[model samples]
Target: MDSNNLDRELVGVLFPGIVKNEDKAITCLGGIRNISQVYSNPSKRRLGLSFQPENPFVRKIYGNSKKGAGVLLKVKVKKVKEGNEIKREVVSTTVVGCVKTMFRFESMCDFQYLAVHREGPSDGPVSCCLEKILPSGVEVIDFMLQPSPLLLIPSSFTRFEKPIGYAYTDKRHPDRSSPEPGDSVHSKTRMLRSSQVSPYTFNLTNELPSEPHEVYVKQKEIKFDLHPRLIEEYDVVKKLFDERPIWSLNLIRYHTKIRLVSLKVIMPCLALYMKTGPWRSTWVKYGYDPRKDPAARKYQTLDFRLRHAAGVRSMIMSREDITTDRERKPKRSAAEAAAVSDEIAEGSVYFRRGMTPTQRHIFYQYCDIQLPEVEEILAPEPPPGYLCHQKRGWLPANTGEICRDHMFRYIKDTLFNSNNTDLKFEGSGNGSSSNSDDGGSDGSDGGGGMSDEGGFGSDGGGGASD
Candidate 1:
């Protein structure tokens, strides 16, 4: 048969070990009943087995060879309880396994191993051994069995009007529409069409409106009643201004979070005082500027007012004078030079004064000068155009023991002296003596009353005159 076209069912049998009397057979059958109940449980619904006895007593069944023939026993299985009680019936089939040819009179009997199948057409065999002998001499045995194998049968189950058993035509209904192969009755047709009547038809266009569409709505205007106190307060405030005042009562109510009457009365009085004080100018500058159009100036005035009020309140409540308590300690005198010398002797080479010329120069450049030396070094030099009448090469001596401050002052003085001498020479000398005709102006007053020979005089003479 074709493997694709097969129908199979699952069946089973139970073999009781041995029975010496009729009552023993009944007891042996009771064991099968217990196994059936176990199989009927929902969890064990798939479990199924079948056993067939080959002999009534001890009979040997032939195998491939007579020497290796196995024993077979006549086994009968009766349905104690159907397995479908708890679940759907499972499709399964069963077959036989090995058996012992000899009847052993031992405390326990053993049977051969059995094989189980998962998807084949046959259920493999199971083996059993007598474990306990009942009081009636019946053998109570337990066997290990495999789950039954089921061959799923395929049938031509379809929703066709007629079976495909044979191909034929009905002569009585010759005009009937024959369905094409694989045509389904639920099929539908779809159509697509263009809105234009003809393929070459052109669309007509319309001109758009020149003006934008405007929508007008009639909204009901609501009027609220002003409290008597609020009205009086508004009147008082309005009296301050010649024109009718436009006060926002909502703003007053929002700021105070109080009744309109209370806010209106209190706000105006507060505004009156605020407008008279130093805050008056600030208020006008920030909030009450009538020069500005209302719509153009949004919440600028209100924001300024809020900030100003907050600042004023903060300033009034804040402490302007604050005093702090700090501990004072006596000033300590500078350590003696001898102590410093001793420390230097014990410190690193860098700290000690035993440095090379280069090291000493670097150290001196890095050190701070004393106040007296700093003053001398930074003192302003004599003005340019001043004569230095001292000996030309009279160089100042450098004292080896000179402090850093004094050394700096000496360098500054030397630079200043050199600069003054250069200025004096340049001021006294003219470029040439050929221009004697233009001497009166250029050589005398032109030179600012200073002579070419490094002297000050009204005339162009090399002499000093007061």
Candidate 2:
């Protein structure tokens, strides 16, 4: 292929490399220093290409200048014959290396290897060899090849220090305050060079505090003695809340007993997804246990529908090797079969779609189900009273809602017994012990009164004196 054809074929690749030292920065393509070096080449017989900022080739080939990020140059090499005859020709270049800037932070300079390809088909044989000269203190860490090109979002949407799964919050807004003091600020990015882009950038706070005073939620102290493992699990969940985007789906296999506690903490953001269909079809699809163990074979079968995020759709068959139809016993009579079919038709539960708010409330309560905003394993509980769905009795004629503190105290009272007697300290003297001390006891002297441990003591003496 010719040079024109090569220019027509455009290809872009991203490579991640490590800098030799943490303190030094990598020099990127089209940098002032690179231009200076190219110009300062000693040999006068040189053929070269420069992808300057305004160069059409830079925009067409690199796709993103990134302030002169991706550029390729091919330089010629000179070969001198015995009697001062010199031969020079352009050399083909591949695998260009440069320092990649970490967003706006130039201080974080790391080496990046970019594979540049122009629209082309060429197999040129350049007999003249270009001397291999590598920059000092530069090393290739790892090479990742991706078929898809990298998708770019505005830098404002993904600032350098912002949390990975959270959207950028503007601190300049007068109505909002900074995150609470205890909220963690640490975050790190994953798949820095992955070509894939997530469709959504989750807002860190779906419901912002209404006022400055409400910005900081008073940390509730867990007064009860809890298992260390439970405490650690709670911390892990809070850390997840800080790290993972709230809307992202997560699968959790949990200890059955602890599942309720986890749901209580994160139910505000959880949404359960349920799929329902004909029992016979679903059972046939998922399969039944054909094992001959009477206990295992006696289990009831129910239909379950699974939704796949990916587009692939096929019925999954069970792994049991036994032939289900052949091993199964035939029904005794047609009358009995008809009776059973009628019973099944009457007893089968039907999940009605698109229920009214009141109907949904009743349905959820009856089914013991609560679907949150994101699907997660959660214990079904009645919705919080503050979020009532009933249209008629929302505000009763003579009813008052309980205060939050009162509810908390009631829960504490129910779960805890008053051990005040053990906590109480009694004095030996009746005067101090029986009556409240208002800076004086009725029968004690005005000065230093009787010491509780020392028994009856006079104002200036150990025993009663004149």
List model 2 lDDT by residue over 128-201, tens digit each: 11112222345354312323333332333212322245567854343333445786564222322311211111
Give the TM-scores of the predictions, in the order they appear: 0.11, 0.15
Tens digits of per-residue lDDT for model 1 on 1-466? 1232123322223233544565444343334574456335423222222122322222221111011234232344444455655444434433343332222212222232223233433474433221211123442433224333332323332333223466576644343334556877643222214211111111113221222112100110111143344555444444533232222333233333345434323333323211111111111211333322322111111101001111111221221234332223355455553333223211111111221111112111111222343223223232344332211001011111122223323333343355344422222122221122221111111212222233322122111111
| Model 1 lDDT, residue 68, Cα | 23
Off by over 4 Å in 1: 1-226, 243-466
lDDT of 2: 0.25
Model 1, clash count? 13
Error of 2 at 238 (Å): 46
* lDDT measured at residue 155 in model 2 versus the true structure, 0 to 100: 31
lDDT of each: 0.26, 0.25
Q: Specify the highest-TM-score model's number.
A: 2
TM-score, candidate number 2:
0.15
Q: Which ten residues in a row are the worst by lDDT in model 1?
A: 215-224
